[model samples]
Target chain A: MSSGETLPAAQAGTVESMDCLVTIAASSGGRRIEISGSGAARFRSAMENKIIQVLDSLGGPGDLSVTVQDNGALDIVLGARVEAAYLRFREAMLR
Target chain B: MRRTMLYLPGNNPNMLLRGHLFGSDGLIFDLEDAVSRSEKDSSRILVREVLRHSGFDGREVTVRINGLDTEYWRDDLAAVVPCRIHGIRVPKVDTPQTIRDLDDALSALESRASVPIGATKVFCLLETALGVWNAYDIATASPRVTAIIPGGEDLAADLRTSRSKEGTELEWIRRMMIVAARAAGVDALDTVFPSVTDEEGLRREALFTKQLGFDGKSVIHPAQIPIIHEIYDPTEAEVEKARKIVAAAREAAARGLGAVSVDGRMVDLPVVRRAEFTLERAGAMTEGGAR
Candidate 1:
């Protein structure tokens, strides 16, 4: 079931204090999320859940690889960054 | 007392992202007047996303929505009131019904969002002569109102005058607003001085605002924060007097006296409360109310 469509790869936000830089790339699994860096474990589930929620809101949950460079971003910051990256990927894929 | 409130453009993600860096007592994310018509949708979405995501780090967070006549205000309210917003400022408010309507709208939004009733506050931006005349009614119209900001530029236009260097044109409205705010038990905030580079002028104007009983002054720039905070902070002598009044009042209460004498003047509940508030604002008071 391949229509030769692939979501674009893009990143949004920075790994600054109280912020999270989200980089999303097209992939095979429904979702592949990895967190690497300090202070990621405790918030790993929360961040992943938020990313899924944002993608769902954007008509997503598509196959994707999400790399979150965490810097203590709140849920809303994470959501916005994820949403921005998702839109960017979606727009690029259409073009 | 709110010493300084910095307004950041709501549409710009960078500014919205960085609003909490400055040490302001309040942060206003402005959607009206700051955002152009074309960018309203994007800005509205961005502000909502930011609000949905960011914690304001103890600073009071407010969003200034477009006027009721605009097509975007309802959307703006739907986006922000559900978030962690402390207050919503409806700009160019000319009638008490404006406040009443906003209150009802906010209540509906709160119910829709499942947030507690009356959790969100509102600030009336008295930007026109009609708004100024109805300031008292607008301030007291809703229990959610916590502050009234006397608008400078729009208000000047409404008054059919231009802003003067000494602010003579806006003085009377400022006076009236302070009375209205005090009578309504809400904070009266002064408008921003348009001249950002005029440090001396800003200081002078802030001093005038403080003397006129303004709780704080709104700023559109970060540089103006310290100048306004300095003027609003209680002076050293005033802090000392506050300490004395508080101590005397506490001792008198312990001695079963209804009123206390501070510096040979009889002090009562109101003065004691004022003294305690002064110390609190000065950041010198602890649980014991002493330096």
Candidate 2:
């Protein structure tokens, strides 16, 4: 699911795009996330690492897919967006 | 150098316990006016105990004692002056001689208690009409006097005027008190902003006081702390402008010039000094990360 996708469908998979993208999955399998951007590979790795940390802390058993839109955002900001998506997904799951 | 001194009633244990977090530069455990005659003794003892046990964490703590003319003055000083408080706030101070007399008594108490005279300072509350008129003399009465605060309610009572929310009646008094305090080279503090709900009014009054050269304003309620701090804190634009001005001045000085120009405005010595002070204050505020 991308940030544009309001509600996730019954299926879980990874989606990617240039503007904005998101990945969602159920917590049955181990979570894996990877991100790449235009700026630097180091930045992408940092963002991926932070999102994984947040997901691990949340302790949900789901196959995770993360999408990134490289609109010249810093690694911290990319990580923040992923964290926001995770929080929203968790909130929706709770509901 | 108390920039903001909050008045906490002596009998309110909740306020006493939370005094340190009020964001004021100092706290005055008020024993006079706030506490009734019947509760004075107990309140004094409680305040002393609070001072002894409560960890104020370097916040200046002063006890506002009952006036010397009152019978409770002796007992109040005997109970509190020996504690590790910062200063003694004498209310209803009307004359230089009155402050001198209080100073003498405080000196006696300090000597008898074996505490250093310099440790226990004095702050005068100019409450009466006569006190406001003689504020300058009272401010300079003794070396121990650190600040002169106006008591709006009593001063209005002495002047036979009704208290107004706008504080129009006390405008002249406030101006005179600031002038007197500046003339005496001591900190001038404004009276309490009575309305806790009227934060806009409080900010207006705090800015007025800051403009009039008052070091700080006294607050009656905890809710007024953020408004006062907001008024006193340098604005984002001010901080940025100050940084630019300071940088320009430093560059100009390095080039053997006495002045610099920033954004087509001349940055002279005084402007640079003001900018430096603003930066220093901003640095102090952000030392432990943004609050």
Candidate 3:
């Protein structure tokens, strides 16, 4: 999915057992990522680092509101869900 | 030893969550035909996430990526190449070049991901008439390739034929693909049974394919697994015969003989090899090469 157009507010992933739900909302300011769940405090830095990696990978941080409803999903799972949400947001714009 | 390989749509969380409990020899997280075009990217993410967190519990796990002709496959490879998957199943493989190109890309990706070189395997799916003809080349294209699967519906359409309950349309294709797989020293998995509701039909097809010597069959529904396994797995008598053959072969080799007599029949290298493979599949062969 290409950038430049306004991203549609979209969400991906789930909050089901041991999974986290990540919702991506379009923003005009910049990428805002947050995580709240079990052990969220302990893994906040790691999760942020992963979210930053995802944003960099997509060349994003372009106007996005992030909400992570974590449920003990590992860093990789979190990253995948975030990337999916990001891609969903971008893809929604194309449609 | 892959009697049943189930295709679990990658985008469906319910499937991913429940797939491993079905007792299939492998679970193929499908990112190609199973996902809608709009959900492609999200599905890739879901697959990658599932790879990390799903409790596979020793079952073989693989991802079937979109055909290399698509724009989505690049991202598919990039996302899945580094994950702890047994292999990647590339669909619509019509040429050896496709395998070569994918292997090269995967090697590069593995390097970037700090993974062991050639850690991942590749399985090719022949979905086109051209792909069926080129199965040998595709199967032999890379050392990483472990199996070549022939797909129905698509293949039937490609061949300008219609699918039937009797499977006469697929007989020739299955035979040719098995020969190609044999020539390339890889397993050949028969196509799926489209009617998931037909347990009798599934059993018949599985038995027929097993008699044709396919190492496995693809399954879409969990209900079909046990029937496939029952058909493909060697019977108790066959396992016993295999064990005896292995023992006889071992005894013959110890005495400097190139052949062994088992049940008044001469067992040569080929027969002994078959026996050993049977024992291996039956899980009766020990680490010391004894059953």
Candidate 4:
């Protein structure tokens, strides 16, 4: 079995206005997603659902940790950022 | 009547989502210079999603891809061409070969995506001295070339100079672009005037380019849109004169005459055609002109 420590982390997006910073890392257990920043107070659940939807579409989250630092990004932006970060993370893990 | 085409940062959600509402003639989502190197991949994804999900309010939407010299251009095209964009603005195009290469790439992408081949147009940005020299060749390079534009800062740098408020550096290049575009039967689009705050300067440059036979100008700021439109839109007096000339020409044509007289001046085929073009620019030909 592979350890999470052997994989590298990957990120996408920036914490700019109407944008978000999404980072994904290898996880040893079940999939986990965390949301924070200016949009988290009111949009944490919605953002989490978006992350889940994108990750699932990309062939499931697998064993990974997704963290989002949003700054008032729309749902579409959030989905794009999550997909980008997860793809990067997946590429890194494969490498 | 594309008097102004505004540039929207590809990576900025706020701009990408709302740029069409600013009342420009078209919108150009910029993925080349506006996006940083580190964010190229992410920006490409973001632009694709935005194009997929958001509507541009029916404005002509295009994207400026990275130059052919870069590794990211093919990826950029693969991302956006499938989105069914109207066209792509390719920068630093120096010869017809560049356009041939781009056309080939786009055809493969469009075919793969089930899009109609040749539906995706190309707008060439002639930024270097060689590019400007080969303007006609580049414009006629492919059937997909709808317009050719002169470069602003990039062209200036390539010419070993910097931009001036009076635009002394780009005058000859602009002239050549208009001539070449017209010779090639394509539209001549002027580059952006970077001094966004200089209203008077922008007006002067727009007027100059319009008089030089440019179809439109690339806009950097939304505020410049109204001014460029004002310059390109036909005035009331001009429209009225055009209508009178068109009416006279219709009567003459009905009588099988070779020439007509409008406002006590002799009008011919060319003059009537010019009047019809004026009516077209005023957006009144089909609505209020002689059939």
Provide interface RMSD per model, one decimal: 4.1, 25.4, 3.1, 0.8
**Per-residue accuracy of model 4 over B122-189 as CA lDDT, tens digit each:** 99999999999999999999999999999999999999999999999999999999889989988999
C-alpha DockQ for predicted model 4: 0.80
Q: What residue runs in model 2 are displaced by over 4 Å at the alpha carbon?
A: A1-95, B1-3, B248-257, B288-291
CA lDDT, candidate 3, residue B104: 96
- Candidate 1 chain A TM is 0.86
Query: How many backbone collisions does model 2 have?
Result: 4
In DockQ, how does model 3 score against the reference complex? Answer: 0.36
Per-residue error (Å), model 1, residue B140: 1.1
Clashing pairs in 1: A76-B53, A77-B53
Model 1 stretches with alpha carbons more than 4 Å out: A1-56, A60-95, B284-291
| Cα lDDT tens digits for candidate 2, B54-128 | 667677888989998899888888888888578988999999998888788888888988889867888898999
Q: Give the TM-score of candidate 1.
A: 0.78
lDDT tens digits, residues A24-78, model 3? 8877578788789884889888888888888789877667788898877766667
Among all windows of 10 consecutive residues in model 4 chain B, the one with the lowest summed lDDT is: B282-291
Greater-lDDT candidate between 1 and 3: 3
Q: Which model is ahead, 2 or 4, in terms of DockQ? A: 4
Model 4 stretches with alpha carbons more than 4 Å out:
A1-7, A38-43, B284-291
The fnat score for candidate 2 comes to 0.00
Error of 2 at A78 (Å): 56
Going through the candidates in order, their DockQ values are: 0.20, 0.01, 0.36, 0.80
The residue-by-residue lDDT of candidate 3 on B65-127, one tens digit each, is 998999999999898887868899988999999999999999999999988878889989899
